[model samples]
Structure formats: structure tokens, C-alpha cells
Target chain A: MSDTFNFFEYYTHISQEDILLSYKGPLTDVLLSEFSRDIRAKLQEDRRTGKKVFAIFMEMAQNVLYYSKEINHFGNNDKVGTLVILNTETHYKIVTGNLVFKSSIPLLIEKCEIVNSLDRDALREYKRKLRSAPSEHESKGAGIGLVQAALTSDNPLEVKIKELQGDYAFFVLGVSVEK
Target chain B: MENLEIQGESGVYFIPTVKLRADTGVCEISGESYLEDTSEFYNAITNWLEQYIREIKKPLTFNFRLTYFNTSSSRSILDVLRVLKKFQEQGGKLTVNWYYPEDDESIAEEAEDYMKDTGLAINMFSFEPEE
Candidate 1:
């Protein structure tokens, strides 16, 4: 066995690891079923390793379904986004990136940072306090889902943002669970 | 009063099916809940429970068999549990049973969190999926 690896060949192989799943159609009831089917397959593979991976997968998938803003095929009313699950040698990484309004990025990043800093006990307490509070906005972060995802994953969440034209930005979150 | 039934969706919101009985005092909220408008969808259920606690003034049993719910829905669920807790505190009979999947530890922990938050006795049931 040689220690040196071919860069181009390795890059091609690594790119194949990227699993892309996108939805852009009518906002009908079947959309849930379709998304569930794809997620279930990924989850089954995660289940073979442990429960934590499955939990992380569920949280990320739900976020994409709930928050993605780029509409395709369907009218503007439909929810849209891209979700990718990649498998490395030692960990399963979930990368979910979606189009969100530029104004929402700051708040979203703030919440992610807050959740990433908290320990499990503090996160649980935070969830309790938010639950007790009154609802303000409909789907904006109440700091529950991201917190749950952080608690479930072994490492802190990795987030990146890119400017995508006027009044819109691409938000990407990468979470990994040990296999 | 008529029963409340809303369809569940994946993208927008999860609609939880609600069945409330004034006569027997049995209330059941089952199915998944990940809704677009969490408060708007659950406000009716909370209002109905309030009316039941005030007018009917009978013993109540709440059964929750939700398979999956997002974070927003979970907050609304806490609201529902709080209403039940309030009724129990006021000398009203109450019981809550939360059924969860056997493989899902998060759900069990969530039920425990609710129990701690409300200071109410809740029966936790572990269920195995049917083959």
C-alpha cells in the first residue's frame, strides 16, 4: 500500500459521497410522504450505528422542510430547499442549505451560536423557558430545534453563509454524528 | 361541539387530530404535529379545554400518541399540558398518557421534560411498531 493518494481520483470519489435530495412541487399532502420515504432510508443506515445519528438526521430534515425559501416548479407559496447527507469514514455528516431572506440571517446565526454554546442542561432549561413564553412570530426560531440538534450531535454545529443576490442569502448548516 | 380534525403536512405544518368529549371527559390528540402556524392551529384546542374545565367541570383524561413533532409544535404541546396542569391544580381530576416509539429516546426525554415542567403525573408508554 502506498501513502500517497491521487488528488483528482480522491476528489471524484469524495464528490460521489454527496447525496442530494431536493423538492420543488405543489404543496400537497404527498410531499410529506415523499420526504419521509427518503429520510427513512437515510435514518435506517444511521440506526445501524446508534440512536444519536437518527435524532440528528430528523432535526436537520425537519429544518429543511420547514424553512427552505427557494421555490421550484411550484408557485411561490410552496416550501423548497436542498438536503444532503454525506457519509465519511468515521462519521455521518448532514448538510442542509436553503435560501432565506437576508434579514433573517442575523437572527438565525445568533440562535445557532447561542445554542452551540450551551450545555445539555442549559439547553433543556432554555427549551422549558421558551415553551412557557408566548408565541410571537409563527415559524421563526424559538431556539428549540437547533438546540435539540446540537444536543444530539457529538460536536458543535458548523454554519456558513453566502450572499445570494439582493435580499436573499444561502444558509448552510453542517452537523456530524459519530458512526 | 364538533370535533376538530386537521390534515397533517410535511413542509408547512403538522396538523394534530383532536377529539374532545364533553360528556365522558376524554380528550385525545394523536398523530404528528409540525404546523406552519403553531399558535393558530392549537389555540382552538386550548380554548376548548378551557371551556371544558370551566363549564363541564368533569374529570379529564389526555392521551397523546404523537409519532413526530417539530420544535414549534412542541411548544404548543407544552401549552396544552399547562392547561391540563392548571385544571389539575384547581381540584379537577386529570391524567395524561404519552405514548412514544420504543427506539426514540428523545421522545421519552421530552415526555419527562413535560412532566417536570408541569409537576403532573404522566404515564409514559413505550410502543413497538407493528410489522
Candidate 2:
């Protein structure tokens, strides 16, 4: 076949990966609620893993909704991002990607490193410290979403940063829970 | 002062049910909370607690029955716990109890972390997960 876009090829790739859900574009509250309902229903058979998967998904999705560099002005000015869920033999992986300011890469990397280095107790302690710290006006959230995600998944977070044109870069975060 | 009571809803966002009684000095926050305006919602509850502690000064029982709460809501919960800790420090009589699903250990662990963070004792109880 010629070097062209093939719909079946894309479909086959997705099927092979066992992608349960995938979404691109704006991340809004409405979308999150709907996705959460669907996920709860889809994973009803395994409530414990289902809860962990949902928790990690919410934390990561909210991270994108709040911090993505790209914003869609369709109505509520929601942030644009990508979210995908993959079911592997051993784990359920929730991955999210969004554009962020290039300057934030270092801090983001440090945060991820800190989260991945700690054990469960230590992660909880770290989350406590961050939560109790004096709140900055600009950042109302405790900035401990990643820490929470790590604790819930009981797996080290996987992070990848790609340099993009201008002042933005793509940030991808993956969290996995044992199935 | 008038009591504060907000009915929880699970529509676009999960709003935790809240009730702060002025007469009995019994306050409850139950249900799931994952709101976009997390801070705003918790701030009012925090303020109400402060007011109750200042004026009522009765023996207070704080009940937490949250099934799920996001990180932002966790921060707000800590804020509320801190207010209670302060009240206890000032010689105000108070008891804090937290309930979670028996299947979910994270919620119990979360309460433990809160206890460690605020230096306040929290009584943890686990119940059957709702059907």
C-alpha cells in the first residue's frame, strides 16, 4: 500500500494496545463527570482496582485541566489535553498529555522524581507537608495531585517531557494500578 | 448564629453533604467531594467552624464520612481539621470521627495522615461499601 493514512491500521493499533478509552481536545468539568461515570460502569466488576484507576485518572486529568498551556475557547475556556486508558495483562494504565510552559519542566521533573523516590508512608508524609504549607494565592490546590496519584496507584509515575516550538512543551504522565 | 446545612449532589461535580448544628454542637461532612470550587466550598465550612468554636464553645463532635475526595478537597479537609485542632488547644471540648468504606484502605490512611499532620487524634471506623 502507498504511504498514506489507513483507518484500519489505526483501529488495529488501538485494539492491540487494549485501549479502553481515549479522548483529545478540551478537558472540562462536564467531560470529567461523564468520563468518570462511564469508567465506574465499565470497571464495575473489580471495585478496588476500579477505585484506584478512577482516582489516578481524576488526579491526572485535573492536572491537565488546570495546567495545560493550550485552552479551548469553545464555551468555558477549557484546557486542551489528551487522555488514554490502557488495560494490560497486569495493570490498568491511565495516561495524560498536555502542553505546559517550557519553564515549568524542571519543577515538574523534580516533583515527579520526589514522588517516585518515596515509599507509601513517605509519600503520605510528603503530601501532608505540601498540604500544610502556606498556600500561595495563585495556586489554591495543594499541588499534591501527583503525590496522591502515586500513592493511590502504588506504582511509580512515568513522566516524559518533549521540547516543543516557542515557550511550550508537551508533558506526559502515566500512572498504573495493578489489575 | 444560624446553622449551616448543604445538601450534597452528584451532578457535574460531587458536593459533600454538610450539617453544622448550632444547638447540639454536632457537625457532619459526609458523601463524596470532588468539586471544581473546592476551596470556596470548604472555606465557608471552615469559617462556620471557627464561628461555632468562638461562640458555642460546647462539646463538639465532628463526623467525617467521606467516601472519596480529591487532593484539593484533602487540603480543605486539613484546613477544617486544623481549625478543630486549634479549638481543642484552646480548651474547647471536641471529638473527631472519620468513617470510610471497609474495602478502601486509602481513606483510612488519609485520615491517619491528617492526624499526623494536625497532631489531632481521629477515630477511624470502616463500614460496608454501599451497593
Candidate 3:
């Protein structure tokens, strides 16, 4: 096979997914700002739903920015990932995929379960506990981000993990906010 | 100690406005906070606060009017609250007021949650018409 890649297949994939906004690369600051503005503009039809959609979009994008294992050109440990937003008739769905270190998978799985299982009040309590708990690492999130996503979402998080290579896996999470 | 004033940047990353005045001893951080380097940006504010707590021993009033802050920035926000709580516990006069839109129940709830974590009574001021 050759080193050259195909772009036509990728376009079809995106079209099939009904992607509104799609980005595949390092989650840089510039990309975030532009995408958020466009997303806000696109979601302006309903203010209430728009707020939830925007919030969820930001949360998911940040997750990819914080956790993805893909490195950048400058040798900085920059998290790289893919983000896609889909606007359907009944809801707004955000899908994010990133490379994850094997060791963190258990914690990530547990967190998803914790958020998915809680009601609004209970999730609020969970968020409080997370904030008060001694933060494990400087690079780690407080876990409240996912809780925030859950609060804005109408459905539980749909998370899938696929083995990629040694000590790395592709982690995908889907968050849906109803319109 | 001198005052520190930072203009909130709405572009690139949602930067919050920060003003710490020695003359009035009022520190306010308003607007959204979503910085590229979260810790680096917040440490500057905390360092200033630490110096103020050490040298300029005076009553401090903190006003937080943030509409949005990412999780990373939220950690820094928690750090600030914890510092204030400690200052109060050590007999330092401290007042924290959080102003948010009345309709934004989420922000109010977050402030309440902050109150719980810090064990400090945070005064919440609301604006905007409620639905």
C-alpha cells in the first residue's frame, strides 16, 4: 500500500453521521473559539435548548482537550481528539473521541456510571463531593464536568471503549441534550 | 501592596475580569473563565491575594460574577474560596458576594455548592427577570 490517504471516504463518513460541526485534530484554543461561536449561532433557534446544547458541547470538547493522548508537533503533551456535533429534529448530540491511557480507563468507566446513575439532586450532591475531595492530580479534572454534562443531558451518557494499540484505547462518549 | 487590574478577554478563551484594589480591599472577578493555561492564569491572582493577606492586613471583600467557568478554572475558583475560608477562620475579616442572573439557577446552585465546600456563608445577589 501507499503512504497517501483518502479524503473521499472521510467526507462520506461525516455526511452519514449528519455532523453539524466536525473537527479532527489537536484541540487547540483557536479551534475551540471558532467552533463554539458557530455552534452558538447554529443553536439559536431555541434559547433554552441552545443553552444546554452549548454547555454540553463545551464540556465534551474540554474533555477531549484535557484527556486525549495524541501529542502535538511542539512536543508539548497536548491532548488531541475528534469532536462532532449533530443536530437532529428532537435533540442535539455531541460525540467526542480521544486516545486514552489504559490505566485511566477504570476510573473513567466508574465516573460514567456514577453520573449516569444519579438524579438531578443526587448529581448535585455528587458534584459537591467531587469539589471537596482532594484532587488526585493537577492534570485531572474534578469529575464535575461529566456531572455538568449529565445535568444538561436528557439521556445517560453512551460510552464505548475500543482497543487500539498497546496501552492505548479509543474512548468515545456521546452526550445528548433534548430540544 | 499595589492593586491589580485585569481586563476580561472575551476572545480566544473566555477570560474573566479581575480587579483587586488595595485602597478599597475589594477584589472582584467577573465574566466567563476558560483559559488556555488555567493554572498559570489563576496563580497570578492567588499569589497577589497571598501577599495581600500577609502584608496588607485589612478586611477583604470578594465579588464573583462569573457566568461560566470550565472545570480547570473551577478548581482555581475553589482554591480562591478555600483561601478566603482560611482567612476568615484565622480571624481575618472576609466577605464573599456572588452575583449572577436570577434566571440562571445553575450559577446560583454552584455558588451554594461553593458555600457548602468552603463552610463560608456566601451572599448571593441576583439580577435579571425570573421566569
The best candidate by TM-score is 2
lDDT of 2: 0.90
Who is ahead in DockQ, 1 or 2? 2
lDDT of 1 by residue, B2-94 (tens): 445555444534577778887788888877776656788889889998988888878999988886776777888888999999999999999
Query: Which lDDT tens digits does candidate 2 get at residues A1-179?
Result: 67898999988887775787899999889999999988888888999999889888988898888889899988888899999999889989999999989998998899899899999888888888888887655554525889889999999989999998999999999998998
Fnat of each candidate: 0.32, 0.89, 0.54
Q: What's the DockQ for every one of the candidates?
A: 0.36, 0.83, 0.49
* Tens digits of lDDT, candidate 1, A1-179: 58787889866765684443443343333565555556566556445344465446556766665677776654656666656667667776777778888999889899888878888888887777776676458555445667777766747889999997798898899888776
DockQ of model 3 vs. true complex:
0.49
RMSD of each: 6.0, 2.1, 3.5
TM-score on 0 to 1 scale for chain A of candidate 3: 0.88
Counting clashing residue pairs in each candidate, in order, gives: 5, 0, 0
Candidate 3 chain A worst ten-residue window by lDDT: A133-142
Interface RMSD after interface superposition, model 1: 4.1
Per-residue lDDT for A88-179 in model 3, tens only? Answer: 87777889999998888999999899899988889888877776676767445647778888876757899999987799999999998777
Candidate 3 per-residue lDDT, tens place, B36-108, comes to: 8888988888888888888886999999988778767877898898888877887889999999876567788
